[model samples]
Target: MISAKRIRIEKNQEVSANYVKKKMDFINYLDNDSLAQIFMLLPISERITMKEVCSKWQEACQLAWHDIKKYKCTNTIVRNHKKCILTQRYVEKVLFNCGIYLKELILSLICDSSIMPIIAEHCKNLKTLEFALVEFGNKNTYRFVEAFTQLEQLKVVKIHISGYNFQFRMLNSLPKDINEIHLFFKPNGSPEISFDSGIIKSTLFTTMLFNSDPVAPSFFSLKKFTNLRSLTIHRCIITDIIQEISRKTTLVYLDLEKCKTKKEIFTFNQLLNLEHLNIKDVSFMDIPNLLSGIFNACKNLKHLDAPDFHVDLAEIKMENWVNWRNLVHLNIRWQASDAIIENIIKHCNNLEFINIDELNSESTIELTKLENLNHLDFEVTNIDNEVMVAIINNCKKLKHLVLPEYNMVKASIFYDLSKLQYIESLNLAFSFKLGDSAIIAIAKNCKLLKCLNIKNCNITSSGYIALTGLKNLEELNIEMSVNVEDNFVVKLRGIKSLYCSGCHELTDTGIIQFIKNNPDLEFLNISFNTNVTMDTIIAAEEAVKNRTNDTFLAIKSVDSDIEKACHEASKNRTNDTFLSIKTNDPDLEKACSESQWLIDC
Candidate 1:
């Protein structure tokens, strides 16, 4: 009699399963075309989300989205989409409207003399200028120098020197009233840079350089820039720069990287206004002296990135960490004792960013106390389940989180990460263990994610499909995920930037359709793949060209081919239309010159 009762209970469980099956079957009773018309009445936001309901609903949502794009809607409410993008063309138009009130401008495209007049005449209040030109530079680039001097209010300028002979042009164009200057030279054999101290009229508070190599003898002295508040140099000769730089009461950000002796310790001690210090690139033999000097000088340091300390930890005293109580960002990029890390956590109570390589069990305990950490990046460190859970539970204010790659952690750890509903950026790139369940978990819970990098992960087509629900995701990196197919383009929309460099499954049709779907896409890196051909690239260029419609651009060269090309480009050219390359190939250079007007390209 008991066995008979158990069989009856088992039969009752099957009833619920069969009922769910019957309900699912009922939804497919209507054809997708009919279901799509009903779904089309919903808002675009809801229509995109409905794709994740089930296979049948996903099909209907795909069709509904297509119809919404093809057929214009009479409903004003359905058309209210808040679209925003920042591109070369977008900024050019925006400056025309708001140049007078603009306080900052960042340009990263091939700058022609075409817009220099507008900037010089209207952008009078511009204070900060980031001239991040990655294009091949030539004599025409120097023409902007005259316009730069007109912006008498410009205080900070960062110019990336790409081509030759423009360094002096930068110096002459920059106004004497500039307070901060950062010049980064590209690694393309830039000419020896020289600094004329006589031209500088105002006090330079900040000076930074990147690969400004073989600088003139006068560049190392910096005799005029005596009141530097912060100075940074990368891949340049630091021996003379450190030895000759005069120490002023205002010089605080220099001691950590340049000075390491007992005599220099007193100068650092008085620098109470120290801002940022990084010594990762410097080779240090005296670890104890370096640490002591930093401890003495870094009383008010807000940011510090220290080098590897794989030394005798017993020789160093961990008691000096209390002096770093004001540190807000600390990056210890190597293995250190648990005691030092514990001391850091205990004293650096205001730390908002922490980057460490390896964390032991003891340090993990200390990490749990940093409940307000906003950023964490552990480089290739395997975080166990307990440590991962501790972080997810404690770091409530984390907006950017990077877990360890190639770990043995369970896939369920992603579910823990998804609990961070407020997180804006999450990176799980190169994790062999991350699969469809992790993506599903993020889709179901992590609604506020704006940037997600799953590059070269173990995600499959189902995982890629699950990403359709991430409506707020603006930047996505699924590069090298071979399983990524055209279905993603059919569902995902409004992505401003996408990097699918090695996705072998993507074809021409999907890419062109994607470009059409997301009209505001600013960046796309579909390189290293053959399925996406030049035809799709031409379509992308046409879409951007139709929007920018810049029918005229000035060319200084006397070449007729360039003039003809510019005239044609005025009628058809868009950003990224021509590849700006530094090649020795004569044919390639000739081919790019006609279109780009840059001699090197």
Candidate 2:
């Protein structure tokens, strides 16, 4: 009944509609793995929006959500009350969607404690939880603490309470499955909670308490944790608590920084399994006895940092440490005599790292006998030429060496060290007499050098030229080296971070040349170079804009007047410019905020 032409027109229209549908539904053809990868790249905010795009995108987002391992909820609004309810709801939605696989959650904002149940119901796999509460009171904190009882998988919990006076009763209600706990309480705000040893009996791995109060309540007994491995206590004087803890726990690591305790309170004999011990800021007159006890009992001790112990080395026999073959790292802040150094070398043959307060020529020579010494830090009034040569010849495997700030050995020291091909990091900062010759010798010999610090030295432009031969140089700090000029910038080839602050001889033209040559530079510090002007800033902005790759450049300067000029110049620039200029000038900071370019003044 229909004509042939009309029938053909209807069939053509149907074919065109079919083609349109295929084009619109093309994303459905992608496999779930490919779609999941694409969704994983989206930000949490954007991922939430993609869920509504289509069924395929929703499935992809769900798959991506399973891959998320950590999430944080921080205050995003300027005013606290102005944070609309929608923000909380949106966060809840994210938690409900991604909580299935999240292992860590950090909460810093003010959220209702009722939300804890929702998190527990969703994030069953959560292992680490960190809460930083400042203004929030303990009104609903009980609910937050109670919800964790249901999370059997939670292993670590850190709570930082400040500004508000939180009751300690809630601490007694924590889950028993948590293996590690860190509690930080500001002065005067921490409440006095009674001891409930049963609550923390199962927590037997690690515990850290940093209480600012001078006279904090010893609420809990440490004797309950028989399986405790690591313990750290700060500020609070818990002599009795530590004594009980030492008697009960076979701790492997102990940190008593800034903790005040009687000498008789701690006994190291029971802590035979102790490996790492930090007693920094804890003063003890009878340190020799304490060291003897630790070295004799804790033979497995590997890392010992007792920089603040006021002990007379002459009173203790160095032979006590001779049997500590397992000792690898030792840091002592007290002065040691030549005899003490000789004894340490004779006994501690396996030591790879040593940091001492002072060492003389003889002590330095004795250090060469340790073939395993790779990292050495010592202070000396004068660095003898023979001592430097002795170290270079004996410690050929030296990778890190830090000399005294007061010592200024002659240029020949570098010539001797040039033979040490394994040196990777060399710091000669504050050595006023070190000049270009030393750097030249270093560059020629140490081809593997990666980090060099010559701050406050007497290096000139010629010295920087010597650095040009260092192909592996990554970080260079020449702060206060005023003689270094613009010509040195061109020779910097592979450096990622350059600090030339106080180099007054460097000009704006020189800075632009350096920026152009090193397009991949990430950090550049030319602060205090009075010759730097607006042109240098403009060149940095252009370099970032023209780059094909996504690289960030951070330039630091102290010239307030030039920074203002650069801010004004950037007004017409596009937002795609990724240059960041950090200055301490107030006017420049205000101007930067108004401009489209990223500024951190």
Candidate 3:
């Protein structure tokens, strides 16, 4: 039976091919599965063209496109197609479906002097319409705006007009009901005109706007969008954008990645609903009044990203900001200071993830005390036994850890971590002191360890022997582990995701022998390994494709059905999928493996 995806692929072939070709430069852009999933979303013509790219992509593309199209037809008001080409028949269909319940509608064409009238003649019920170009100079964009007046339910509209610049004065009014609007520029681009002069006028009600122009279309202001929920200003260098945003108290999310701001004293009161804020590549000498304003106004805030800045707060000043109890994620690059951590942990009780790249011994100890902490990402130049003991003793709920270079760590300190049973993800990158004992202690203690990253750890065959006991381990990253050989592969038979990149000591004899036997693996990254070649990936793929049902091969001494079911289920699923299987009655070892190390094993 021809699936819906196959039909859609046949309908949208040309555009899909171009998109795939453009993305081919990225080595990790999209795997076969991800591509298959994406292709299903494309129109039939696009999907068909994508299927022709390679025999391997055909079936997955066909199936995915079919399912998504079929699902959309049942609930959507928009018809699926690759690109918009306004024909008489297409125009008639749009006019007839003017009141149609559409979720998404795409329009693509080289808008020159002729295409705008055709689009205006149809497509009034558009929930989403993507335009390739808004033909300028022809004075046709104004007609397009007039047609949008009837699209009362229009939620999203994206227009790209490169060579033709909009007098925008012509676009006197925008669709007030539209929630999302994206404007793109090609050769000529949108005029760098801001609403500063009040030359352009519009009553278009849009929650978000993506303008390629240096200045925002004066249409966006505090009084313009009372119901605005979120705002994103990309590629624009408008000063005091935050000050303008402060007037919009309803804003919940704001992303200012490349924008710069003066040392303007800004308060967070206006953006009271803000929960997620991202400010990247912007420098500030002092985090002045930032924390206090955020805590006072955005009490419900959850995530904060403030990089390349250190903050020194007085204890009294810290008291006012302690009410930020709702914070769950924090990213700050500060000097290693114990007092700072004590203040931070004391306030944010429910913090789940924290990225403090520079950590000191005193701060690491304080980190161990945050009971609600789940993920800890930091880099340390020097870690002592006392700090290690503090981690195992306090950060009992920690599930992931990213360690710094090994030469900076004392080997004896790891022994203390043998008690942190909850740690499931462990990364020991760039380490020199980590040896067999440390690896063995981890293997023996972290029985529930799922991901172990020991890149460049200088581990040997003995380290492999120690790791073999981690039967439940799913991901093993020993990249650049200079001493790792083929024998290490033999020890990682149960790991579903393995990275042996730069393991110069590995040989084909060892790799091929294991690839033919270990079929449970889902991702194998052996890049930069002199011993491995293209044949290695091919061999791994073949093993995965031809995997046999071997339940008896699974270690069954596992205490609960969850572990048994997961072990058996892994044979048919991806590593990530298999890792998600839950165990309701996990063994004591698995339950205790949260952050504290060895509990049962």
Candidate 4:
């Protein structure tokens, strides 16, 4: 019933709507600033594309460029690429935009003369600073010396001064509140450099001697460090530092590595609060003076790690047996003298964990019979079957036991281990004498066992069947076991971490089946299993990547097949899901070494 005029008006309204939409699209395309702002909200990888939008957009980003620079929420920042002069400028630009307030800073490069000064002025609030590869001449070294005086809150500083006859005015310019300091100087001859310890609380001297000097006060002239708590001297033969530490009562942790002393016979009696002491590579085996200091003064000693100990009772007086109630972790490595073991047995009643890499029968006497022992490692060269039985019977509370290499007996060796019901982590690897019977006995007992390493052991497929009952098991290392087949992995559904590495008989089908079944598994090492193909690895990696946050799902598979899968997964890792792949490659190891927190076991 409508007229011709009304129909015409409706058609015109529809055309006008289409024209307005086209005009709005054109406006959006022209506004580069607005586009850049929108791009800023996207992820880092996506934002890289914004640079190509237009020159105007790139200029707009300059103002808010701090948002574009990378941020490391973790402890370390590892960049793969190398830096040059131009790259340094770019780095500076990014850092400037990111703001100068930093918790830690490591500048390792061949920077310009003025770079240090700029950093000192800008990074006033820096807590830890490590200058690694920078080189400076004698005159340029003093340029940034006074600049650090403003950094009043600095705690730890490690700087490598590389130059001959370098004027290190920083000694005088250093602030007094610093708790830790590590200096590396490369100077010609005996270019004297001294530090004012008025502000230092806990200091470490890591000096590489360029030349020798007789009159120098050595590395440990503590006339100023009255508040020092811990000290570590490395590579320098300045034994005078030890004498200085003898007077220090506040010292708790003392590490002296490769520091030679002229006087072999030295006694210490001063340090009362010293708990952890490590004196290594001094070459003096029969050090009675050092022993006197340790036995008498360090009453609060908790953790002791001395690798070279002579267990000779003839050398140590029998009447000097002092009780160390506070001793907890005792590690006596490579005891050349078996008599020292008796000395340890007499004292160290409160010892909980004892790691003896080399212990003879003479040393294993009354100490192994301790009821308080929870963790014990022995590399006994001269151990009888009776001595082993005594160790197992007496130390019923033992949770971790690692026998010496080439020291495995028959299956009857584990007959006494049933008494140690609390044993959790057992490493009978390289013990070829322990057959399936031993493993079966272990499964029958030691229900708390979590980590069982039978690598290079004589374990057949039947041995793995016994492990099916170990529901609490987490890690199992059965590397190089020829008898372990595909069905053996089926028994490991509860296990979170598994190492079937070098199982040449294992194929892709077995691995696929295990992955499909064990959804709780987080770490699986199929390295050296050549039968596992790339297709199967890819499928497993994809399945793991789709899992939830609490599910770790790590594949520690090496070789070309696994590496290819990992590379593909890494390229697609976008969401909160993290994929960690461990390989024999150096690059992979380096990556793993960096992310220490991600390691489960």
Best by TM-score: 2
429: Cα error in model 4, Å: 1.2
Candidate 1: segments with Cα more than 4 A from true spot: 1-154, 163-178, 189-232, 238-240, 243-246, 251-270, 280-288, 308-320, 333-335, 456-460, 528-530, 548-601
All candidates: CA RMSD in angstroms? Answer: 19.1, 7.8, 18.6, 10.5
For each candidate, what is the lDDT? 0.60, 0.69, 0.56, 0.60
Residue 254, candidate 2: Cα error in Å is 2.3
Better of 1 and 3 by TM-score: 1
Clashes of each: 0, 0, 43, 3
Cα error of candidate 2 at position 389, Å? 1.2
* Residue 581 of model 1, lDDT score: 26
Which 10 consecutive positions of candidate 4 have the poorest summed lDDT?
75-84
Model 1, 247-270: lDDT tens per residue? 444655542332221122222445
Better of 3 and 4 by lDDT: 4
Ten-residue region with minimum lDDT total, candidate 1: 70-79
Candidate 1 differs from the real structure by a C-alpha RMSD in angstroms, to one decimal, of 19.1
CA shift of 261, model 4, Å: 7.2
User: How well does model 3 score by local distance difference test?
Assistant: 0.56
Candidate 4 residue-wise lDDT, 110-170, digit = tens = 3455656666676666676666423445445466565567666566666665433323334
What TM-score goes with each of the models? 0.62, 0.71, 0.55, 0.58
Number of the top-ranking candidate, with lDDT as the measure: 2
- Candidate 2 achieves a global lDDT of 0.69
Superposition TM-score, candidate 4 onto the true structure = 0.58
